[model samples]
Target: MAGGDPHALLAAAADQMGKPPEGTPRRPRVGVDLGTASCVLVVLDSSDEGDCPVWVESAGSGALQDGVVVDFARAVATVRALRDRAVDALGTELSTAATAYPPCIPVADARACTYVCETAGFEDVTLVDEVTAAQRTLEITDGVVVDVGGGSTGVGVFRDGRLERLDDRPGGGHHLDLVLAGALGVETGEAERFKRERPTDALPILTPGLHRIAESIRAMTRGTDADLPLHLAGGALMIPRAGDVLAQYLQRTVVTHPHALLITPLGIARSAP
Candidate 1:
């Protein structure tokens, strides 16, 4: 397997997201991510550069918790809205999509993610694990891809571009919000805002939570190659210096990307057939 530069792919994805070209030779493929905090829709051209995102949009929804689709109807509605927005922006109908679930969830729960996309009107839906979806975007031949989302941290160990091991644990941005909320005497919503808008002030208060997440990674990747680098995806660790904090705690190289939150969603699109 050939290793491609994940940083370059992420940069291109960032640049192309939400800005589809006027006309292209191939139709666009779609990826839908039903995250605990939000639902994202990503579209990409089926051309050679399909790795780059063509259109992207997100909407906050409480249909999921810890990557499990709890409110089936709400999840379907959220995805429908996102798909409609992408179609309107690109002036193309999106009939097929790929979606993902965290690796820790039961197989039945994972199927809920696919159902949501299909219920939202997608004629064809592909299902993949969240960690594998992220790998599709990063193309990391040998490394650890960690997707720290609102409710869980999913780790995927890869060698020669094949997934060697995968695991996920509950503990992510939402847990950090709880820690910050307790420390600052604020609501969880306010804590989330503070963490994002004033990370410098919030990082100190949230370090312990970050460490917990790091420990989860350490536990999940226990038997994998110790020297492999760690690549970060998902939004929880999008805070400035979060990667540095993780590296310092785990004493391993950590690779972060611009628009880290979009990695899995874009990768899900890449999985579309």
Candidate 2:
């Protein structure tokens, strides 16, 4: 059995923060995140303390189309492109890479994630579930960890250090953009920019959208809400007032991270063998 430090990998991937010094290893571990909006690749200089993410790179990709590999050749080429760029950044060849899939995906589709890495020329591949990967970074013992991606929100509730509930509901950043677009009569991209830049002012306007997400969380945590806290680990809800809004909606404590988007991808790297 083998395990790598998902936490340290995440920390270092985000500029080597909170990691032990790099150590000698056979080779650096590479990770690729096939996201809906972008495809990201990360390299970790693995050690006993954990693999330190030495480099991170991403490219805009519409090929995956909401976490599913709709266009196989496009997805593979995207992965390869990101892989080559990351290898160049780290000055090493990426022979082995780890990738992740969203929760509840079928085996065949999950295998596609590995195939993407394999097609990218990695001899070794590791596959991790997106929610479990996020936990590697959050280390949530007893509570819910919600990952709000552009198209869906995946929730995992843990009780006494074990996951008790898991589910996914579609409503996230893109949904918020839709709400903003309708209200302001702006394009989705413009609304996305507005929501990101002026989130403080956009909070009240986006309340229903946030509540929709909160309600989804409530639905996911119905059985476990007795005393469990809610820990948010995703990019879509990174807006400043999101946690506060969710806390008020759920009538429970909500935890937010400094850089939520990197949590799961880094966690996936940590899950490498």
| Count of clashes, each model | 0, 1
Stretches of model 1 off by over 4 angstroms after superposition: 1-5, 16-21
lDDT tens readout by residue for model 1, 140-196: 999999999899999999999999999999998889999999999999999999988
Point to the candidate with the largest lDDT: 1
- Poorest stretch of ten by lDDT in candidate 2: 16-25
Clashes of 1: 0
**lDDT per residue as tens, model 2, 154-199:** 8888877788878877787878889999999999889989988998
lDDT of each: 0.86, 0.76
lDDT agreement of model 2 with the native: 0.76
Candidate 2 TM-score, true structure as reference: 0.88
